[model samples]
Target: MFTSMTVINILLSLVFLYFLGKYLLNMYFEGINRPEQWAGKLKQGKITRELQKAQRQYGDKSRFFLFWLQIERIKKEQIQGTFAELGVYKGDSARILHLMEPTRKIHLFDTFEGFIVADLAKEKGEAASYTPTNFSDTSVDEVKRFLGNSDTFVFYKGHFPESAQSLDTEKYAFVNIDVDLYNPTKAGLEYFYPRLSPGGVIIIHDYSYKWEGLVKAVDEFVRGIPENLVLSPDTDGSVLIIKNSVHT
Candidate 1:
C-alpha cells in the first residue's frame, strides 16, 4: 500500500545500492588481482604488440597470461630440448609451435589417417562418436608446405609410438598432446613425460571434464607420478605439467 512516488523512490534506491555494491566489489578485486598492472608493462615506454596480439588472439587475459608466462619462463631458463606435437591433424598448432621457438627442432607425429583401430578400441563410446574419417584429409607434404620450411622440421607420418621410435633418445621442452582418443593420449603422455626437459612443459588439450576419455587418460597416466598437473582455468581446458627436476 505505497504511493506512486514512494514506489519510484524505492526502485531508485535499489538501483543506486546495486551500483554501489558493484563498484565496491570491483575495487576489492582490483586490489587483489591488479589486472591493470598485469595487463600492461613498460617496454621502451610502449605496450608490446606481441602481448597485445596474444591477448586479442586468446580473447581472455588470464589465458594469454599463462601462455605468455610459460614462453617467457622457457626462454629465461634456456630449457634445451625439441618441440613436439602428437596430434598434428592439419598442422595448425604445429605451425604455431614452430614459430614460437623456431630455433628448436619441432617433431610432428600423426598417422594423417585419423584414429587407428587400436585408438578407437581404447575409446569407451560408440565408434561413430570418435570416428577416424576426417583426419585422412591431411598429409606430411601438406603440413611441410604450410610451414614453408623444412630445416627444423621432422615429420613422423605414421602411427604414434612406432612413428616415435626414431625419437627414443629425444628430449622435449614443449609437447602438445591433442590426440582425442585414450590410447594415443596415454601413449603420448607415457613417451613425453619421461623425456621432458627440466623446466619444460607438456600441455594436454581436452583435459576438461568434457572429454571423458582424455580426462581418464591423463588421470591414469599421472596417478602416482611425482609431477604436478597444473590445469588452466581457460575455456580450452588445457592442463600443463612442468618438468621441474633438473635430473630427469
Candidate 2:
C-alpha cells in the first residue's frame, strides 16, 4: 500500500497534469484562431486619438472605440452618405461622429424633453423600471455648443418618424439609434434601414437582455431584412446592422 505522503503527491501530480493539458490545448487552439489584427497592440493614428478623446468625454470607451473602427471600415469600403443619431442625449455621441467625419452632415434627433407614454407602452416587463423622461434636461442649443456649433449638424427637436419626415429622400452612411423604448427603436430601424446606403451601418443601442423591449424591437424589425446583425462586445449593449454592398 502507498504511504499517505506518496498518495498526496500522486494526487497533486494528477491535478498539475490536468491543468497542463488544458493550458496546452488552449494555446494550440488560440494560435490557430488568432485574428488578423492583434489585440495586443494599440490602434494608431487620428481615429485612435479621436476615439480616446470621445471615450474621455462620453465615458463609453468600448462603444466609441467600436464606432471609430466602424467609421474606418466604412471609409475603407468607400460607403457614402450622411450620418445620424436618433437619441442625442447631451450630444456626446453626436460630437464623436462629427469629429470623425466633420464634412458629412450629421442629423441629431431627440425631443430634448424625454420619452413619450405611447412609446414606453411598447416596452416589455415592468414599466416602472424604465425611465420614461430620463433625458429631458438637454436642449438643441446645448447640443450645438457640445458639437462645436457646426452648421453640418442638424437638430430635429421632436418625436422621431414624425421629425424624420423632414429628411426627405436622404440616404445614411452611419446611423446610431439609442431610443431605449420599443416603439421608437423599431420605428428607427424601419426609417433608417431603407435609407441606409449600401455598405452603411446602423448601430442600435441597449439591445442586451437588460432591455428586453429594445431587443424585441430590433428582432421584430430585422426579421425579413437581408442585412446581418452584429452585437457589440461592450456593456453599453449596442448592435450593428450592416447594409450589404452592391459590389459584394
Candidate 3:
C-alpha cells in the first residue's frame, strides 16, 4: 500500500530522528564528563557535589549559582534567621536552597493548585496569557515528596500572605519570592521585607519584560526600599534585595 515517495519520506524521517537522538546523547554525555563551566577547584571553587546536582535540577545555572553564592555570604556574615520561599513550584529551587543550608529551616509557601483567578485579572504582558490552571501541574504532596519533607522543610499550602499570617513575628535570613504575577509580588515585598532580618537576602524572580507584572511590582518595591536592586542574568531574570546591615 506504500507509494514510492511515501516510503522514501519514511526513510528520511527515520534518518533525521536517528541523527537527532545521537546529537542529544552526545551533548548530555559531553556535559557530564566535562568540568562544571561555572566554578573551579572544590576548595577554592566552593564547588560541592550538591552544587552540581543543583545545576542539573535548576533551569537556570546562574540563578542556582547565585543562590548558592548568596547563602554562603549570608553564612559567613553570620546572618541569623530562618529561610522562606514565597512561591515554590514542584520544590526544585526549594530543594536546592534547603540542601545548600540544611541547618536553616525553609518555609515553603504556594497555592500548589496554581494562579489565583483574582491575581491574574489585572496582569499584563507574559502573565496575561496565562490561565488559572497554567502552573497547577503538581500538588503539595508531590512537591513534599520531592523535597523529602525533611525536618528543615515546612509546607504552607495556600495563597501566600494569607498562608503566612501565623508567622508575623518570624524573622528570615533568606527569602525567595517567585510568584509570577503583580499582586502577590507586591504583597510578598510588603510582608517579607519588613520581616527580613538585617543582612538578609531576598530574591524575586521573573523580573524580565516577559513578565511585566512581576517587573513592575519589583520596580515599585525596590524604589521604596533602602537596598539597591541587584539583577541576575538568569533565564527569567531575578531581582535581589540584600537588607542593609544594622550598622548601615
Candidate 4:
C-alpha cells in the first residue's frame, strides 16, 4: 500500500508541473508577442537618452520623441516622404517631425480649441473634459516659436474632414492621427490613407485605449485595411500602421 501511494503522489506532482509549464508558456507568448508590449520594452533609459540628445540638437520638445523613434525606424528600413499629423494639440509632435526631416514639410490639422465640447458631452451623456473655452485659453504662438521662420511646417485650424478635404498634398511618408473620436478617426484614415507614401507609417494615438469610442474606431479601421499593413502597438495606446511598400 505504501509503495502504491508513493507512485500516485509522484504522478500527481508531474501533472501539476505540466499544467504550470503550459500556463507560463501561453502567458509568455500572448504578452511578449504583442507589438505594443514590445514597443514599451524599447522605451528604456538608454533609448530615452538617445532620443533626448536628438531632440536637444534639433528641437527641445517631448512630442519629437515619438516622431524621432518612428522616423529612425523607417530610415533603418530605408523608407521615404513628408510627415503629417492630425490633431496638433500643442504642436510638439509636428515640431519634432520638422526637426528630423527639415527638407520635408510637416502639415498639422487641429481645431486648436481643445475639442468639440458639445459632441463629446452628448457622447458621454455628461460634460466631457474638453471644452470650447479651452482653446480660447491656449495659444499656438509658443508652438510656432519652435519653428522659427521655418516654412516647412503648416497648421490647419478647424474641424477635420472639412479642413482635411481642402488639403492637396499628394503623398506623406509619415502621418500621425490623434483625433480621439470615432468620426474624426474614420475621416482622418479615409483622407490620409490614399495619400500615404509607399512604406509610410500612420501613427494613431489612443487606439485600443480605455476609451470606448477610440477602441471601436481603431478596431473597425484595422479590419478594413489590407493584411500587409502591419499594425504595431505602443505602450501609450498608440498604434503605428506601416503601409507595405508593395501596396501603394
Per-model TM-score versus the true fold: 0.74, 0.78, 0.83, 0.66
Winner on lDDT (1 vs 3): 3
Superposition error at 26 for model 3 (Å): 9.8
* Local lDDT at 3 for model 2: 100
lDDT of each: 0.75, 0.79, 0.85, 0.67
Model 2 local distance difference test score: 0.79
Which of 3 and 4 is the better model by TM-score? 3
lDDT winner: 3
lDDT of 2 by residue, 10-96 (tens): 999999999898667756644453333423323433445654445445545467667877887887788989999999989877888
Instruction: Give lDDT tens digits, candidate 4, residues 1-248.
Output: 56998999999999999989866775655444434522564565434544344444432222345566677676667666677888887776676566566677788788777677544653331224555665454446766775578888887778887876667766888898886666677778888887887778888876554556666666787788873334444454577677766834
Write down the lDDT that model 1 would get.
0.75
TM-score of 4: 0.66
- Candidate 3 TM-score, C-alpha based: 0.83
Q: What is the lDDT of residue 153 in candidate 1?
A: 85
What's the lDDT for candidate 3? 0.85
Q: What is the per-residue lDDT of model 1 for residues 117-166, given as tens digits with 9 covering 90 to 100?
A: 76776565333376667587888888878888658988898888889987
Better of 2 and 4 by lDDT: 2
Report the C-alpha lDDT of model 3 over 85-198, residue by residue, as the tens digit.
988988888988987888899999999989999999999898999898887998988987888848898889898779988888999999999999999999999999999889
* Span of 10 residues, lowest total lDDT, candidate 4: 55-64
